[model samples]
Target chain A: MPKPNNQDANSLLVLGGTSAVALAYARLRASEGKPIILVGRNSDKLKLNQADLAARTKKPVDIHVCDLSDTAILDKNWNAVTSMGHNISEVFLAYGLLGDQLKTQKDSQKFLASLNTNFVSAAMWAEKAFDHFAYKGSGQITVIGSVAGDRGRQSNYHYGTAKGALEIFCDGMAHRAARFKGAKINILLVKPGFIDTPMTDHLDKGGLLWASPEKIAKITLKAVFRGKRKIYAPWFWRFILLLIRMTPRFAFHKTGL
Target chain B: MKPVLSWGRINDKYCNVVRADYFADPNLLTIAESSDNGMLLAHGMGRSYGDSGLNKGGVIFQTTRQNHILDFDTQTGIIKARAGITLEEILRVSVPQGWFLPVTPGTKYVTLGGAVANDVHGKNHHKVGSLGAHIMRLSLTRSDRKTVICSPRTQKKLFNMTIGGLGLTGFINWVEFKLKPIESSYLETENIPYTSLDEFFSLSEESAKWPYTVAWIDCFAPKSKQGRGIFTRAKFSNYGALDIHRDDHIATWPFVTPALFLNRFSITAFNFLYRWRPGARMKGRSHYDSFFYPLDGINHWNRLYGKAGFFQHQSLIPLERSKEGIGDLLDIIKESKQGSFLAVLKLHGPEYSPGTMSFCRPGKGVSLALDFANKGQKTRQLLERLDACVLKHNGRTYPAKDGRMSAQTFQTAFPQWTKLEAMRDPKFSSSFWRRVSQTTS
Candidate 1:
């Protein structure tokens, strides 16, 4: 899908909106007093985010908790979100898991859980959102992919593989949307490098490279509104990823990356 | 990613900063259990002049995102707002409604929580007291994850402790304060010249009936002209029209001015021209902006002091001994040749504040707020000398403006320190508390 030009479209539907990046994006939109429908499974986090957004924004924020890993639940949530009447100018997809890499490598259940959350659930949301938004013909879908997916990191390869699959699924969605007339479905694949969030709490973070969720959200919002089809958050990540993608396999193995 | 500094642009520190959108639980992050300075301090607009607001290598809970004016009553002049709401915000909403804050500090860039935490006093402090005087209620969350609502009447002791508690008591969620009704946002102000400290005292005494009064001293003046400066007296003009001019802030000091640019020569030159500024003796009709927050015109004006940072020393001496105490203090300043251009002297009424450790006592306050480029040993020695003179006269310095005051100074000033220590949250502590309290043992 080509970049859509209509950024002033009234509403936003954010899945996994409780994530720090997603919450910051929602806040930017809410500060403009715009309507937002937040979807996630954790009611506690949703409630917390809801209180925060409500206090900051003039509009009444609506939160719906649906476990995205469950396909039936995703369908029900899709219907519920569409019915809320935001016109859902943009559907922000932020659901995924960075499950413990060592645990996942040893435990099949852990690996499956990560894969189901990072790939299968995203695919389900994309299919449901694309079908509905395509019929409507004017909306955007933003999925947060990661730099880890560019070339699997040894420490986080499981999560990376799932994200790699999700990226291909989104590419197919973008291609299929071209066949439908009047459907200006802009699909944005946002790839962010190391971000400081609750997910990265275990890592000792402090540096020029680790972008705060606020910084990533600002970059993501700028890209989405400008209708960029793809973006490496912080913009500099584009160069970092290019260098990584160009590394020859023999040399890359020698580097122990 | 860089270290955050306070308004004074001194004592910069790095911390795991978190945004408390609305109300994020303080305990969510696995912060160290009181390691060195492990306590999480709520940072608002970074307005404090010293380490009172800094958490060295600890967590800082940023409350700027939680700014929301939840409720306002026009007739009763009551407003309920989140702690993160700034005075500039309150003025934006309340000014045009013929209302204003009961008390305001020198700048409006500070948050309501910070103002309440410091219990800041304005020129009208003689009449209205500190910001805490107008606060009707507050919602505070404890380190143990319990939320409590307190006012002067309910949870009386806790309410008083949290007022000027410097954020050690809990996370202030929201505050309710009674806005003083104003005729208009314009003030009919008068500026007069005073030649001596005795003359200032007389002028301050005579102007007690005026709603607001404050005097700026020319610290650069020779001993022959010592205590000579301007006294600005004002009261809201009785126009009864709620129409106030609002202009978008367009110009700001984009970057920090180099330290060398603010030497004794430059500060003295500015003070000389400022004292004799055009219409210094005229009766002027001024907006609340110039009358209350003249420094707010320059964004990060504190940066003008350079990277070393400056200290703002505000000491209160009992009314009876004020002349001798302030005289000794000024003589010490003159002898040392370390003078601040922004020295202010005011008289606080005898109405005792209920905030146990609130700095505003019934006395005469002489504030020496100068930017000394933090030349470590010499600067510390100069401030210590000033502390000695203040202590000799039984004067006490304000904790909010304090950076390096010895524990002896704090203990002597507020003998009630033991009371505050008893109520201090075990999970909460600060760099200032540790530094000053350590001197005891």
Candidate 2:
């Protein structure tokens, strides 16, 4: 397969279009003349965001409805779309749900469902995207990881564990894809601290470095364009998390994270 | 290769925040040419009262790790070193050898790069301009990763950009500046008390003729005595006639105070006693370290602010708006019932660098610094109000000290913000800029 020229590679496929961070990323890319294809479960929200993005960019955007929680449905729709000439040069896998740990612990079904949505679904999408890019021989995949994955805390270890798996998985995928000749698949894993997003709207503000969605998206896009392997959103979180990880175990357990 | 580093966690009582980050030891490779693909922001002793040294997630070319003295020309008083070198380090080696940084901030722990970033003004700003004026040349790594040598005559844009660019234009790896030769570590210091704002200005104007002058204003003073404060002036002692000894035992404060200790009442009392203290006249041999970073005596002084860190709101108003601007600002603080004990006033001269967003300009700028207890939303609202006033007077807020000012105010304060944005590297960013500027629609 021949590499797509910049003009021919102007389409974006955002896996989690309903995400404000993902939407912001889409908006930024759209501003740079790339049309976006928003993929998510919420048809109404996706349509609303599509309209908002079109109004912002003054360009038409496409929308697709697919609930990633149902792996079968997601794969079916993904296969059908790829078959229909959707040559997406960029695949943003930003879908994830922060399931209530207490509820998940009480119900095994809930825990399994959360795990499938957060980790399993991400891996499936990554594998599919990698295969697609290998066939086309060029593309970028960006995954929104969490700083909680750096070190698990009592507060949200379940979510952290899921994110941790995704991070390691992406790291391995990046390493493996680099060996394939003529195939260019750059992976960006974003480890963000507390972000003022709908997913974290109920939680109390965390720290001085907690970033806004728009800020995270701007940094994320910048990193994607630069082909960064990994980035800590709101840069201070890098130092902050580094300190948290390096804290001596004897003192770490005593000092509340 | 993995980076070797040392780390320290200090909770500031003044700002009431905990700062835990890696500090590059004096022996580490502080600035590797390989890392120059991204820009580096030199962090001195982390005492700009704000974000000048913070590079967010990007690499902050830690200068403290490479504070070795490269060379010192004793005869002409020319000094060159890696930009990470601190005023305290220079004073440590030179005070005994009879030399000093041509300019020093209130704190000696400040890195040479920070002084240039803030273009720090001291008691003698009126006479010396700023630290940038004394800087002869700098070796910087631009965004393109080229190690370019810049001086006033060569690469003048990069030179000015590095000076006050807030570490945005590039990383300053090494700098060469003119140093003032000193005879002794002691200063001939005197404190003159002023009962009113007019008197403070008169004394500041009069004392400028001398080599050094700084005023400590009492914010709690009544309307009639609004600027009533203590004025301290100093000049290098004629050590040629006195016996001088170099001792490694630098005088420093040793303990951190409780956060609640720096409240309005405590600071007000401290200011009153400081202004009217009996030991107003003193002539003793003091190390350059003690003379500059008096606060350095107490480690983790910022911890005094408790768990909710504080914000230092420092602004520069045109000399014409000094009296009205400062007076109105103080009145607002008083009305808000917010207590500020630490307020220092100084007269600024002309700005030499053309850093697109340089905070200093031509005028007698008065900086009003206050520690607002990080009371969450309340504190943020207050800062927004203060930012409004700063904008009203055509003044700008320091990005280093600001964690909450909006992009609109930033645009207003820095009319050249769009131009700088155009120049920003897509790959480079910081938490400070990310939070305040990147979020704006």
Candidate 3:
């Protein structure tokens, strides 16, 4: 989403370049013949994505290295991307840590590290993009939250807490965008449920409810183009999450979702 | 964990499925070395009809996520890509650029690695041979955690063994291959109706001048016109738009049709109407997707065979004896009253694949592919009898489409299996290999 005057600004900036969902989304947009910029922690993995995108679309693809845990270099990395001379009209925030909930329950260090990666670092990066978009007076930022953030569960409460925090940040950003006069900036919250990505490789994904990253990515790009504030990927997840949120405390404990 | 079955859905292997990614920290080989799941195998798209991609009670590395096109040269028509990328994905990028796969299987869902592993052949086998013939290089990682970049010029023997190696040699990291240049995405095709086995053979010979030729035989035709079919020949049209196909209206088979739905009566009727359909005897222009992959229009078409699934038997017979061999095979099938909805017949040229264990012979041959709905013991018996006929004709059954060819038949037909076994990675094994080699471990 860019201002009516900046329609020529077409470059897409993807923060989690190595992520399957992010890469899929980039591919869908790459066909439009627009430049793409990727930022991630792993240089080798990012290089592969760069090669794939560039070779397939015959479009310019650039990558920047930025480890989310290393907060000191966040500003420097953001600056490097913004100064690359491309009109980056949109930002896709897709990086997050799905840490082991059982291990985090016992190890305080691991718990905090998961929080730092999923929330503290993710929110900081999203905020930087928000500020830039606001300054430009028109842009869209899509943050990938999880359906698990709808409510805290015993299985992954820590991970849920981090995503839940991100959801709130997105909500506040939406409010801020509306209040800023003459600005058309928008924030889209994407809550994907049971996505069959490498991140969830350990889970049994044989159920019909599980969706491919490509399907989720397709839905996400369409939502961003339509200026949607928030959407649950695959559409069914919205009703499922609503039911989970409405459950009574006693019944919820018995079910143990 | 969910059960992992090959396309046939006949062989169900209890595997600890592990998703492999290019960005994985330890990498695929290291992950295999550390796993205690006894043996390992890499499954790409699971498009192989049988157990060739399965590792029973072992660790199966699902490489679908490893898909990525690394490089493409529009001028030279050469492309390099990771093994996990599917043919459909590659075509989506390359077709509009006026390049096409030199040889492609009937379905574009097969992965690059699986194509090399099976050395799949296409209708153009008469002109370009198989996919292995066009491959320039491969990146293979053996069980010792050592990755080797092999080509026909360097490490030639490993390269040969790796092709059609059934993922037993090692994990295929990526592949680089040559592509055929095309002027358009459409083909000027001619369809001719012929009756009798002799007419089919004569039509095949006459159509040899054409770049691509195949026939669809009605196995259930009346006794007098037993081997009658529609012969088709095509060449890439010189002038047309190079438009990449879009899969907007692909219909998925909602669920497994009941096994009863594919019985003799239904299949026979379908085959009857299929051969005499309005467009069955016309010359026309067709998109590459329709000409190459008609079944792909319906996603999950395998479900049509029912919960038991179906088995594909593709036999390659020498040109000298193909007429008699194929006739005998079809006669046996007809006598068994098992109707094959899809009965394809194609001719292979003198060109052979570079693989030592390649199924297609160096000399000219005729291949017949038939699909049989799984009928439990009855179907198993029919397939074994077909294998016996193939052995008598000095032909071989394709491993990629075989579920139950006896060890004797396999070892006899492919005596070079020992060479591949010698170079096989110690940690990699597949259900097909164990069954055909009769090796417990």
Candidate 4:
């Protein structure tokens, strides 16, 4: 058990328990001796992660399996986890589907599923976490956005739009947290570049642009602790995305980036 | 996909690389089943000095992302982890808990899968044997879509074959190994400078009681000081705290050092200075990292040899012929003037590893490892001559460190190649295996 700051020991709640980035962040905070709660769709993956984190941290690791896309049951899912008497101090929303752009563009079912998981479902969960944290007036919520969210691209406009909306929601949540007088609530939005994760494994993941999940996780944790509102992971993506967004409409269409 | 080079960077082959996901790999079975042409090999860290981890014009399953601790028993010191987890990661968790790996190579960057595939050894080999001896069970996923759980008591043949199996048997999913209990992460060490082969042997005999023993000989030393070097030995200290070394200030070689930087003159000067250094004969407490993997402090230290890379030649000679065999080998290297940057010598006990293709012999012997810069034909010829010398002494070169061993030499050294080849997953193959087995895709 963690050395308690008050009556209860603070805990970290990861929305996407099996995500490489989320797990990396969890490991970084593991030395604090805080309990961790992992939520994901796959129970086997969750159990494996639970074992891994529990061993490394030597602390309690709880797991809950729920399809994040099922927005209808998010209330029940959130209640099932938060009601377990873990004084949740931080929540990391790090799950999404990078659906096939070409396939999803032609298929509405895939498009909605991607949109629902990335935005609607994710937004609903974020709201619940934000409300819970805001009610306590002392908590953190980190959402993993993407550089693609800065400017829409034809290749991944659906994902870009969903992440863009999520970022906007995070912006509002940060503002809301500030509105709570004397509250220490913090909201961090981390927009990462091309991370060399399994999600982007299909693409040619070479060159200086691609970053590892561990690197992003480190950057995200630093930003969370420092209470930064928004930042691009790897730092270089800020300029690259700036250039892409600055490109003229006609020229941008010609480049098809 | 990009080209995955070996640690030596000798074989410049562009491979179709596929990385496993963090906790789940839904396509792993599909990829293995489809790549039935024997061009697929599992790769982790790419730490092997040779092409055992490389497959040209083939798919390489990169398992680094699968790194995760599956379970750990603090009471029994038994730990089960994904094959992709590195030894450094294991130590970070285990060391503070008063446990350590049964056997670790010179570097902790190697993955559990790579360590098992190579059946790596440490200075403690004489006491605890190779890493294969400590492994309790392992889960191997083959190309046939079967996950076989093998241990010493069950699936024994496959279990033995998988150790030192060069990742050819199948993909190692997870490994359950016993950890040696330690009161502290520090070791009581001693460095004794010896002058000749005879004195070195005497020192080895004297230090038989030590758990870890190894020597660093200057290959460029004059004929009189031929086998002279510092013989270092160590055992776990009972007085220090169990704390893992935090490597926050490791120095990395920024780039490939110029080939001209490491010439005969520089190496000879370094060898002279290193031998006569102030602490050459010092005795004190040392951290396990400094005592076991001093080279690991310099990240990408291999780049010091230059862009063309270097070749690591490790050979084990029988005890009876060790003095003469080692003398002849040193003479050959000295005459060639192809001095090595790191030359290590150690005595091995008469302990056999469970791995069928393990490089160490069942009989007592002495193993010598040296690294020579890739001077093209000069280096190749020198290594071949060294191979001939080892073969004359009825010794075998380690496949894990070998980049170019003729099929004849390999077959002569390890006659059981046919057995391992027969059991090799038809869909799995490596450049080293192909070259040594004289097989084609």
Q: Encode model 3's per-residue lDDT on B306-408: one tens digit a residue.
A: 9999999999999999989989999999999998999999989976679888878545988999999999899999999999999999999999998888889
Arrange candidates by lDDT, highest first: which order? 4, 3, 1, 2
Question: Per-residue CA lDDT of candidate 4, range A1-257, in tens?
Answer: 33323226788999998888998888877755678999999999899888888997777788889998898898999898787668898999999988888998999999999999999999999899888887787898899998889998888899999999999999888888888886788889999998888788778767899888889998998898788989999999999999999998999999767
Please state the error at residue B364 of candidate 1 in Å: 7.0
Clashes per prediction? 0, 21, 0, 0
DockQ values, each candidate? 0.10, 0.01, 0.67, 0.69
**iRMS per model in Å:** 5.7, 25.3, 1.1, 1.2
| Worst lDDT 10-window in candidate 3 chain B | B25-34
Order the numbered candidates by DockQ, best leading.
4, 3, 1, 2
Residue A84 of model 3 has an lDDT of 76
**Model 3 Cα lDDT, one tens digit per residue, A1-257:** 22222235478999989988999998888766668899998999999999888876676788888786667788888888887767888899999889899899999999999998889988988899889988888888999999989999999999999999999999999999999999889899999999888788777667779998999999998898899999999899999999999998899999856
lDDT for model 3, on a 0 to 1 scale?
Answer: 0.87
lDDT of 2 by residue, A124-218 (tens): 98888888888988889999989988998877778888999999999899998879898988989999888776577556655676776768998
lDDT of 1 by residue, A1-257 (tens): 23322234467788897787888788777656667788988887787677656544545578888787876566677777677645567789887888898899899988888888999888888888888787777778999999888997687889999988888988898888777788898889999999977787667777889997778888888898898888888889989989988998877777756
RMSD of 4: 2.8
CA lDDT, candidate 3, residue B22: 58
lDDT of 2 by residue, B269-313 (tens): 877787667755454445444555566665566655555557778
Least accurate stretch of 10 residues (summed lDDT) in model 2 chain B? B13-22
Tens-place lDDT per residue, model 4, B37-152, is: 43688888988898878887677988898899999899999999999999998998898889999999999999999999999999998787899999999999876667889999
Residue-wise C-alpha lDDT for candidate 1, range B36-78, written one tens digit per residue: 4557778898888788887776777778756666666778888
